[model samples]
Target: MAFEPRQTSVGGNIRQAGERLFAIVEGALEEEREQLALWVPVAMGMGIVAWFLLPNRLEWLGFCCFSLAMAAGGMLLPAGGRVRQAIVLGGILACVGCVLVWGKAMAWGTPPLPRAAFMEVTGEVRSVSAIPAQQMSRMLVRPIDAPALPRQIRVNIAQKDVPEGLGEGAIVRFRARLMPPAPPSLPGGYDFARRAYFQGIGATGRALKPVKVLRPSTSAPPLRARLFAHITGRVEGPGAGIAAALATGDQGAIAEEDAEAMRRSGLAHLLSISGLHVTALIGAVIFLLMRVMALSRRAALDWPLMLIAAAGGALAGIGYTLLTGAEVPTVRSCVAALLVLGGLALGRDAITLRLVAAGAVVVLIFWPEALVGPSFQMSFAAVIALVALSEHPRFRAFAAARDEHWLRRVGRSLGAMLLTGFAVELVLAPIALLHFHKAGMLGAFANLLAIPLTTFVVMPLEAMALLLDIGGLGAPFWWLTARSLDLLLVIAHGVSASPWAVMMTPTLPTGVFAAAILGGLWCLLWRSWWRWAGLIPIAAGVAVMSMASPPDILVTSDGRHVAVRASTGGMALLRAGAGDYVRDMMAESAGFDGEMSALADLPEARCSDDLCAVRLDVNGRAWRLLLTRSDMLIDKAALQDDCASADIVVSDRRLPPWCRPRWLKADRRLLWRTGGLAIDLNQGRISGTKIASDAHPWIVPAVRNRKARSGNQL
Candidate 1:
């Protein structure tokens, strides 16, 4: 009898604990019921990412079919509990997203130029972008008779070579040297070829001679062009480019030095047409419209002035978006603004994660490729973090509190701005590191002054100047706008000059990036105490990234340039005369901002006419690298002996089968297969921008030229 009573007591205690755990989970689910829809876009974005990561279009097609089947099956599932329903819905949305991006890639992907060529090009100009800093202009052209070329090609023409009145819709003929869109200079670097493919740009080239205009444009110039010209003409000096970039989305005119300063100081977002500019414009319009409409007492008393003002703001936002070429960031902002306006008209609060999610879905539906871009990731991340911060109970209570003194209110406003900036920076740091390998350390402080100045003084003055220019009364506003821009540039340069301005990092692994992003989203998306648990993954990602090491050797796709890590923890270039573009790319990839030394000057390197031999200490072992310096034939015996002894070999010429390196043979043949390479001796790994086996529309597989057998036989 005693043993039976003890067993019953233990069973009763276990049953009570299980019931409590179930109740807790059920409560959490109920609390999050209304927020379930917010994850739909996130699931879709995951699918889009998967599509991009897949190796080939055939696999993408197969995945699309699989996704569709899953979605269909999800629809047929029985009415389960909320957890099952949520899982099924998320799976369905993810499938839809995968299918959507696959379809877009099929419809929009363009074939890249197979090889470089010099040809007489006759085409109609579809669009033109000026690069006054370089004294050049680029045009998007549709070929007249070249059936072998892509539908559109971007050609750069010198200022002196550009024909007169060669605007959009003009027929022109010119002799040009064209080349395939360049691939990433280093592994994990920017993929210019992929970007160009999606943009319908197959080739890029520079004109050899002056362009001749066969026919002039019949229609008037685009409004965006007109506005750009007007702003550049009105404002003198570097400020003109800044003003133009702010008004329109064309950033080509900005001086390179000035743009770099802006980027380093974290003020570059001001140059882009994004949420800040759109919100300022819409808010100003609504404020002015309400004031004007409410001035009529009868209208204010009886009319829906708020609704009318909201409509006016929406129209202004839409017009601004179109005027700025409807770039992705501008379009995203416009969509979000329109949603907010709709909420205002309906008397509901709408500046929430749900609103952001809706805007993301709309953009993804049309431009799924944007999911991979830095702009979309950073913009959405900042917004999500800010919204989540604002929704916090403590933040809401503080914001809603009434201040007794005007100074206290001002302090409160500033505090709020500071908090919001910190949150944005926190969330966007990983993304910036992933894309650019650097994040602005002082961006929060810089934005405190830059955001207000651009929002209140520069943009408003520019808008007024453009508006008043219709009556020839814009001189004063134009001057004020220019002065404001000058101040903004000053701030940018001053902040960027600080030694602690930026935090540079080595290329982040994709898994680390994913962990950070997921953790941030978890922290931002959830409304319960468990959301704080996301910090564990975020911390873990940071820890891993801090311990990660950069590659020891970097090689270009063509094997023309090589950068090796020196004992001083800096990069040394095989060719000292390599252009700034190549040097900077190598430096960035190596996460070394200091000056690069010449390999010949290093004590561990010896250079001859045809080859440069280097010795690097990696993982406590001396690694020998034989890099070709010239195309001249090397002594066969000496080359084979060197290759046999070397750990890695790089050359533009194909090596013989007997001349094999123990670790890697990154010669012409291998480089042709794996675009650009990063070799990590510490990890015994090699990463390429384009994998040897990767098959994609934008990637042209390399094939050996049967006739080119002169060098290999030696």
Candidate 2:
């Protein structure tokens, strides 16, 4: 009888625990039910990421089949369970996203230039953009005579080489030296060739002679071009560039120094047309239209004045997007604004995660490739962070509270803006580090003053100046605009000059970046206390990034330039006279902002007329590297002796088979196959942009050309 009572008691306890667990799960699901849809885009984005990470294009077919199977399996599961349903939906959406990107890639992929050549080119001018800072102009041409070339070719023409009155739709002829789109200068660096492929630019080159316009453009210049000219003409000095950038979304005119200041200060977003500009303009339009319509009490009372104003605002936003050349960021913002305006017209709250999700879906559906770009990633991350902040209970209460003294209200608004800036900076830091190898530390503080000044003072004044230009009464407005821009510039330069303004990081591993992104998304997307758990991954990523070491040596794809880590913790260039672009790229990749030293100037390097030899102490081991400085051939016996003694050898010319290095032989042939190379002496590791075994569509052309050359030589 006593044993029976004990057994019954234990059973009762077990039953109670089971019931509690079920209730907890049910409650959690109930809390998150409304937010479930927000994860659909994330699922889709995962599939897109998968597509990019595949080694072979044919793998996409297998991936697609796998995704379909997952979706089908999920659909076959029971439907009444919320957890099951959520899983199934996410799986289906992910499959859809994978299929969508594959389709887009197949459809949009363009053939690259087969080989480098010098030829006379005749084509219709599709577009022209001026780079005042460089004193040059670039044109996109659709070749008529060169059927072998891509449908569109981009040419950079010197100011002296450009014909007078060159504009879009003109037929032009020029002699140029053209080459296939350049690959990333170093591993993990920017891939201009990939972007070019998607953009349909088969060739990029410099014009060797003056361009002759056989037929002048009959159509009027585009509004964007006209506005650019007007703004640059009306406003004098560097501020004119900033004004034009704000108005027309063309930032080519901005001075390099000023642009650098903005980037370092984290105010570069101001120069780009994004959510801030679009919102300010559309909000002003709606406010003005609403007031005008409300002037007639009948419209306000009976005709739905708010809806009418929203409609007008929508039209203005679309027109503005088109006028600004409809760049990706601008289009994204316009779409989001249209959604917000739609919500207002329908009398619904729209500034929720759902809104951001919808915008992401639209962009991903059309420009799936953009998901891999920094702009799409950073912009969307910032928005999600901001929206999540707004959704916080404390923040919501504070924002909703309006009955306060005028001074208090103003103070509260300023505080809110600063807080928002801080949140955005926090979320965007990892992305910046991953893409640019640096992130602005004091960006939030810089943004505090810059945002309000640009949004309220500069944009409004610039708009007025542009509107009044038709009457030639815009001088005063233009002057005001310039002065405001000058102040904004002052802020950027001052902030950028601070010692602690930016944090530089070495190349971040893909896994670390992914972890950081997931952590941030977890924290931002979830409303429960479990969201704080995301901090674990965030901190882990940052910790890993901080401890990561940079590569000791970097070799360019063409094997013409090499950089070695110097004792002073900066990079030393094999070629002392390397151009600014090469120096900057190497410096950024090394996470070093200091001036690069010449290899000959370094204490550990010995240079001759033909070669530079470096001895490095890496991880307590002495490593010797021999780098060729000239194309002159060395005596085979001397080359073999030197190569046998060295730990690594890099040469612009192909090394003889007898000249074998102990570790690596990075010669012209090897570099041609690997693209760019980064060597880490500490870890005894080497990374390249392309693997010899992989055959991606973008890489096939280069491989084929190389094979053809080898065949001819044979």
Candidate 3:
């Protein structure tokens, strides 16, 4: 065929369509400029306010350093050689400067603190994680600072220790030395230090010896402790507290089962008090109150009423945030909502891209660490996606069609919801998976149902509770809502049970996900269609998986212990017992079905179908083998023979410490059954065969040292 000159016609049509699209976007951008300008400064101001309000309050000195750094970073911004590079580089340096300032302030402020050696320190538990409210514990600790060392030591218990009954707000002093957290016992397992780094915990008191709580002139109460206590006390109803949690993201009273349900159902954001909660509150309150006002002729005409309701909603949002301890997510959501709502109240407009950017810059300046958190990314992503997708002029075309049928309106809502979910998840998923290690395959589906429920059902009930409490009849509402919550949980559990609900554990490296998210963001925000480039990071992530060298052992931080999971094989617990959450995390991450297997299974899950046992004889000692759930055992007589024949015998457990497997719990291979006259396998491999001990063994440094803790006094 001749070269198709006919394509010339299509090309013109495509160019025309592109021009029209560009015109539409340019118009919208023009409309948004004013709103953007006003919000930018307001949000920036609030961020500064937060910096002043945030605890670990380092006023002048820290502020000076940050101001200088921001000024320095400002230089790179105008270079304009590369926008993305500038933003990234400046953000990184700013973050580093802030972290340094914060760390220094934490270390140097107040009483002269001393580093505590584990051996020298005698500490007492201040608090531990007995509930979802506080994930970890605080210990009243002292440092084992002697002649050679003079560093302040603080110990944080992995789990919460403060009694739910005693409450965290109480002030107490520990007369003990603090020890830093220890690293994980196994290579490629969880990195405790890294986890703590993210968590902002500096030291741990795992080896602390209990000492009397001193009443000696105590210091000021910790901000978190006071905040936790205040939140716990405010909401007293059964579901009222939980509802308040959803309303305020103050999970001080929410049950763990509910949290699990939310996670399984992909509604975890509901409890986060971030974009989801704030958006729902803003929309629901605005729509309802505005409608109520619009209905009344007098109220409709009265701008005062509209202002009052908007103010009410804003106040409610702020109050809820305070109750939740005003953590980073709530603060961001509140600030964002405040900007939009303030714009509306001022008759200005809505938030614009410039506004979002300015708000982000200011927020980062204050809580620079938040720039690296999911809240910062997801919150901004969701907001920007909503603005871009919802404010399209094409929505005008649906106006005529909506008049024809009610179903059309509902359908449009659903469609909008789906579009929003897709847009935001597309933006947030990469980072979510990278940081969290799992992606909800059907989070969009779950969130579709959940969004309306939260807006319509959850928030309404919580609002009503406050009113009912004033009338002394909150119990009824609480009981009624609790049942409704159960239904939501059932839905969550059911959806979670669906095979497609959640993706299997997948590897998500840091930079790769960051790249993907940035690409998606570029696609979403840029006037260019190149946002489709978001696919690059996703593809990179997928490609990485093919050659992914997953940690040999997988571990999760539960604020208490690191749950060990196996990716390929060769995973074992160093200690005899681990917490339930750790076990569950290990099982889930490794895709094990609660079996003894590590990956897809722990090391010893033979199941009821197989019953095998063995005893190894080495150096005249018979050692029983480690049996997972498998009905495997060693022969008494044969064990004796092997012991006589071999040099060193091995058992999975420390049977009086003599027969202890010299290797870590999961390191040893299955030795053959001592008394096997049974079973045959086609392969040469046997689950019960004696294997050579690994030659180049790994030795993890001991996280705890009894000798080190003892100081000159000891």
Candidate 4:
């Protein structure tokens, strides 16, 4: 009887504690409901992105339309059912997202090339830009004669193959063999083909002959290109490339080693014209204009000088956007800047969460596909984090101090930069790890030095140099800009060389990244102790990612490159030196050494002229794999040897009939149908998965068309 009473008392206390926790959570949620409600569209946008990343395509376009209609019907209901209205709104927005994404996929998927072949094409050169850090150039040509190709095809030409004086908007003819865009390099790797589809690029090829300029061109190259040329011509060294890259968004002249250093140090963003550069330019222009106007007492008194200054800042942002060719990042930044300026004109908070949400919604609606890209993810993550950080009490208190001295202001500005870097890295780390499988551990420290130098020194000099070049006095500005760039390069190299600089990690599952994003947003949106609940998913995601394992084998799409995990837990190349691109992809994905090791160096992999073999242990089961080429297929001795010894045979030719029922095999036919193959071995059983198959535009045009036609009926 005493034990029963004690147990009852403990159980009652536990129930009371649970009820208190629940009440606190409920109150926090209720308090945050209104603020969280605004992100419905943003959540819908994320849903749309998720739909795109799904492995298998679903016919949900009609269902999405139906849900949207149902949502519209909910709005007509009486206002009493607030909970019902919220549910209806969320489901409807999610449906709208599905519809928009399906529509974008269909729009971008305009019948991939019917076949790959050599062709003679004559087209107008829409634009020409140098391949990054390479002497070659990529020309966007709108083909007039090639009816089977996309409206615009990207043609790559060697510097020598480009005809003299050829420029943008020039009508030209070239003979080239075009192929459809390369498929995903790995299973669920970056989809260049999908990106190409969205970019209106269906075909890519190398020019077989020099481009022949057809007509007498009256117009000059594009304004951006002309500026690039003039700047490169005047600045005569490697730094000239960096100068042009900053001024005009052309990184073609940057050295590959220097670029890698920047990437390793996480300073690559400086090379790209983005939010920081745009804001600096606009702010500088605005400050100068306001000062100039302030000097004219009569004019200042007669006009709304504040409004005039805001308008001028907006205009400067627009001009700089145009100067950079309005790339995606530039356009996004410009939109945000204009939104802030518009808010100022309306006497509202310029950098409120609502303004950021509105800008994000607009960008998502117009460019739903961008959500799949690393740039959009990284860019928005940084912005969202910074905006949230700006709301903290410490920052607010610092900003409210208006009468601060200049020295104090400088100190605060430096402190703010460090905080911004930390916030951005916090948000972008998981995202970068998920997409690129790499992160710069020391990126924050690197950016502390790089950001201020680029912002206050490099960009200013570049801007001044552009202006002075028109008057033949640009040499000094360019010299100074070059010096700053050299210093930045040195810093990047030094930082990248640090022992704890770059962290190459294994691939992270998409679900982990999505969970991390959700947790981050939840914490950012809510202001309560209950917000700590968001950390659960974040911690879970990191735990899962840390446990990720590498694939046992990797085979390229063309069966030209093969890598297998050795018994010692390192990747061993079956072939050396060929398929460098594929090699790099596998190495990075598997979290092996960054460089592809020679077959001879790996003790476990033995190679001959026609064959290479490696042994892999998965779940303590031995898997013997043979990597061979076409010529080895016809050699009965080699085939017999392979069939007898190997558990999995990966070859460039069809397996001989003798080996069909004997061992599992992947050959040219299977590989061609499915872009690439990854095999998993467990407990003496073998199974394989392909990168992708007929769902791709080039693979199943007929099926895609049928699906599109049937989509309207759900």
Candidate 3 residue runs with Cα over 4 Å from true position = 1-179, 182-201, 206-241, 252-257, 280-315, 391-401, 546-578, 585-714
Candidate 1: stretches off by over 4 Å: 1-27, 61-78, 701-714
The residue-by-residue lDDT of candidate 3 on 199-301, one tens digit each, is 4444545433332233332344445445444334544444434565664454655666666666666777777777667667677777778778788897777
Task: Supply every candidate's count of residue pairs whose N, Cα or C atoms clash at under 3 angstroms.
Answer: 0, 0, 45, 1
lDDT of each: 0.86, 0.86, 0.48, 0.74
Judged by lDDT relative to the true structure, which candidate is superior, 3 or 4? 4
Task: Identify the candidate with maximal TM-score.
Answer: 2
- Candidate 2 lDDT tens digits, 528-567: 8777989999999989988989989999888888999987
Kindly provide the TM-score of model 1 when superposed on the true structure, using C-alpha atoms.
0.93
Q: Per-residue lDDT tens digits of candidate 4, residues 373-435?
A: 888778777888888888878876765556679999887877777777888887888888877
Give per-model TM-scores: 0.93, 0.94, 0.61, 0.89
Candidate 4 wrong stretches, greater than 4 Å = 1-30, 55-58, 62-82, 394-415, 629-633, 661-663, 680-714
Query: Scored by Cα lDDT, where does model 2 land?
Result: 0.86
